[model samples]
Target: MSASTPGHDDPVRPLPGWFDDAKLGVMITWGLYSVPAWAPLDDRLVRLLAEHGEGADRDRSYHAEADADGFDPIVTTSYSEWYQNSVSVPGSPTWHHHRETYGDRTYADFRDDFAAAVEQWSPEPWAQLCAAAGARYVVPLAKHHDGFLMWPSHTPNPHRPDWALERDVLGEFRDAAEARGMRFGIYYSGGIDWTFANLPILRADDVARAVPDSPEYAGYADAHWRELIERYRPAVLWNDIGYPSAAEPEKLFAHYREAVPDGVVNERFYAGTPDFLTPEYATRATSGGSKWETVRGVGLSFGYNRQEDASWTTSGPDLVELLMDVVSKGGNLLLGIGPDATGRISPEQDAALRELGAWLAVNGDAVYGSRSWRVAEDRTAEGLRVRYTERDGDLYATFLDRPSAGVSAPPRLAGAAHAECVWLGGDGTVGTVTGLAGLPVPPVRPGVPEPTVLRISPAPDPR
Candidate 1:
């Protein structure tokens, strides 16, 4: 990882080496919004934005109070974590559900329920699950857009007194993750805080304006951020939406780096420098050459959506392929898990994660500490998709689909001397590599098909 170019005032910061090697990470988005754990279960946010064009219509105002009909985007938003803002939109699905389920109760009214649920929660299972899934790091949300803090913060919210939890959930999670030899990070919603601005974002344009720019809010956010750094010393300082315009993010970045030299900052800081870029639900080909991460939930929403079942969530095999695709393009995958109010991971999500873990336990060498190869992708004669990755001077070819016996070698491997060929998940080498013209493929398994990895030693230089 190279150092980023310095801006006019912001200093240059190099990305931490461990980040690139840490191919997979888990992000936990559990907060007050989990109490309801409800969303419309509509199309993913990326698709909605593409179809609706960011909901920006100059002719009409889409504010909920002005015209509920114009705010179709918010009504169908899939992010359950935006409950506070969503419930504020009149006639929106969330608004209707809130009225019908818990009449006249404000979003903050669920505090007691959340606290009760937190009492039953334990960080042990979460950390163990992440470790089993071959995750190299864990990032838990400390504060979200709802302005509820998961930790007992020293800087209390002025508008919502006693809004933070007495228990240090973030610290507990960090300790559990680190105990398993995984790095712990924190995610903070620095841009929009409902307690500070109290604005319901109905359109894409509303997002920018929703950020609280008041000096008081800036000082409050800065204080909380500094506290988080000084206490936890997170490996990654991830921010979402944007930072306050009134705050000096450069100073914050300097403070964080000085406190933890190897810590990295994400690109969401609207004002300061970033150690890496974070692309939500984006493909490696689409994400640029810089150190970036692809973030998305097991289901549609980062906050648990009760309506989402196995059909709506990504399958285990698909998750493995997604990680391979992202890693092949020099990117990391920060998969998200949204637990319910009781901190219980849904069965559907848990199964998928375990399946992914099972696969990683067998073929992790193809992923962890691997870099992009000469060609990111190729197709074999059997029409099977193949992704390439390189580590320790060896080339890895991952077949997305099961390949038939005696599959033909890809054109890229032609003329390359294969010192050894080992089929991951199988006993050592698959017979002997007779020639470069053809290579043997592993037998197809009975149940769910998984990506097969073939590691070729002494890879031919692509230069």
Candidate 2:
């Protein structure tokens, strides 16, 4: 396979079981952009349609992975977190905002402004929020492509000496999460740090060319990665873009393994078979030999997209359905939230998370500590999909759309012989059958989301 191809070859066997049980993780992307916190959520699906040939299916094109032949990454990356580099491209909307907002100021000035705002930040509340949101882990951006380190850094800043914070931001988050009994992870921009090489990527294919390549940059990234492992002992070492070519993949992996014995890594780097593969916003979902994760923004942008209103964001029901879809496909969801400059989670993002948490509070048995069934999904004649999960001899059926009416057909679990079927988060039995549980839309408080789950067991216990 070419260097740009998606898959890799290495010998990291079945990932730690704890990761498979962790159905949900929350990822925060906050940085200098959060100061301005604005980006245009372009009609990305429409852009893909325009890029694909004339006869491509419009519906499929919208959801199709952008990695197909001739597929471009530029059309897919609309993240507001990339404001620094995005603004450098002459005709982009970000560039227009930069020119109008601060005529002669550099992005470094924005960094200085962000540093001033960092004084008001605290990680405890964020950690508490994640725990409440039913997240098994929390991953925050360590250093983005912008190169502004969130924590006090021992590694030299490629461009400036005073670029990082004096406070141990990552340490604070780590302590808070560990206190909450949740694993802590770090998202490092291993491939490209704009300060080292600011390559304006205008087309989809320019992504490979954008990464800075040099022993200097490799050493810089290696130092930062080692420092993170040494200081944080992160459970998840998530990398983005790609690792610098000069960086030795094998040695880095060994170093990380030594730091955190059961450390889980994402597949974005080309080093080896990561604990899991990661498909970003516009990538194809893969499953089979290896574990995988799917990361998505609350809306179209990963950074706080000021332009994204309720219409652009996923509602509670949508999120539940999304989580079920990923789990059914044997993948985990690292739901992304972009906090504003004050470090407060957006109300929209918070609400969605809490909604998922509330649902999990009632139906967590169906999600957490569960494994995907051999047959992941079963579609009814009504076009609704019922996703399956198994745990401790009990079976779970998650409906993509809540059962507004009885499903035309529901799959019978192999040994399911329940006398009572309890609707998740609801009082009474929604359905009762020996083998299959059917729902006619269980009653729920107003504004409570759908995509309900039913616990199927041989025992008739109410609890």
Candidate 3:
């Protein structure tokens, strides 16, 4: 209830306990962009930024032709959700693809197709999938950068009349998620709306420069946020890009808190404080000792990309490892999934989510409601990666690789001579620290590469 400053050191409001305990969330990015669902299978945005600094500009010479090797981070962006902006850039693959496929068709033309596709979408399947994927929460995009609204809203887009959908997608999703005992959240692109300010956004600097500074846009975004909160009452308000300079996020946050007392806001609001920090495709060492969430797509693109296949995505084992790493470091993983315009999740993506859920079904004790241990990370004698987490007075040591015979226990666990060990999801028989040198290797499930979890009880005191 205290009014705190907007910075890492000070949060506007404390994060609810459910957020940290949730550990895993599924973010859905679907909109008009999914109608085309096309993006060059180039490197991910993070790799592109790392290869050519974020400030780097696109080559002008390649603006007239499609060069397979042409370099333009923004133009060739892997995020299909940025389709409108990418198609606006001349000569880029996305631009050329747009011209060739839908010649002379404006980006807004996809709205009709998107609407037709939505008629077939049922939020029930999505809710079921998230629940099956071991997601404690689900956040679906209400309004993406394309300025197209996914749900019917009372507050309409002034520039594009009736741009919103007729179906209450957000409300339907919220009801479905809540019915399944999962929290529901909303993602809104508050920074740049193509309808408000049509900037190609060809360069990194253009991202910020393109934010509509007009009072009209400020009021419009603010109204939309309020409407979403009033209608859906999401548990998480996940804003993307950045907020408008003209809007007062503090007032919005206050209103949101009043509406959803346990709700949390992401850091992208730009103006006011956030309940948690969001890092896209990156993770912080300690997250500055504040709660954080790592967001990344099942593949390179957050929006469905026709070009991406199984090879482009992280494997099931890798996904489990990523989750272990984040949770062990006191962070949550907000894994993203982009369904096509027809509301169909890709087979590869579906399989990966199921696989992750399968792993969680067995070893969830190490993840759910767990906190980072005193030693968050370490290496075993065999050089295999080990991550530690604590919950309910028990320590969990997750090994990235299957431990073999003679593989010594991690240094932290080596001293616990009286500790009792149990292989999670295995038989009820308990193992003890025989000599404080090595841990007994549990039988591995054939063909499954998921990380192994070991629960250890602390030594009893000599009373």
Badly placed stretches (over 4 Å) of model 3 are 1-12, 43-70, 434-436, 446-449, 459-463
lDDT of 1 at 289: 52
TM-score top scorer: 3
Clashes of each: 0, 3, 0
Q: Which residue runs does candidate 2 get wrong by more than 4 Å?
A: 1-5, 45-77, 282-287, 404-408, 411-420, 428-432, 435-441, 445-447, 458-463
User: What TM-score does prediction 1 earn?
Assistant: 0.90
- The alpha-carbon root-mean-square deviation between model 3 and the true structure, to one decimal in Å, is 5.6
Candidate 3 global CA lDDT score: 0.79
lDDT by residue (tens digit), candidate 3, 1-463: 0001122333546679999899999999999999999988754444543332211222111112223465555667777888888888888888999999999999889999999999999889899889988999999999988788988888888889879899888888889899999999999988878888856776643565567889999999999999999988999999876778678888999999999999999877766778887656665554237687877788877889988899887777889988988898888999899999989999999888888888898899999999987777778777888888889988888998888876787766766767788878777645676434666667676544568888888622211
In candidate 1, what are the lDDT values of residues 266-376, reduced to their tens digit?
877756778777656555453235687777788777889998999888888989998998888888889899999989999998888888888888888889998888788
Task: Pick out the ten consecutive residues of candidate 3 with the lowest summed lDDT.
Answer: 54-63
**TM-score for each model:** 0.90, 0.88, 0.91
Best-to-worst order by lDDT is 3, 1, 2
What clash pairs does model 2 have? 72-204, 73-204, 74-204
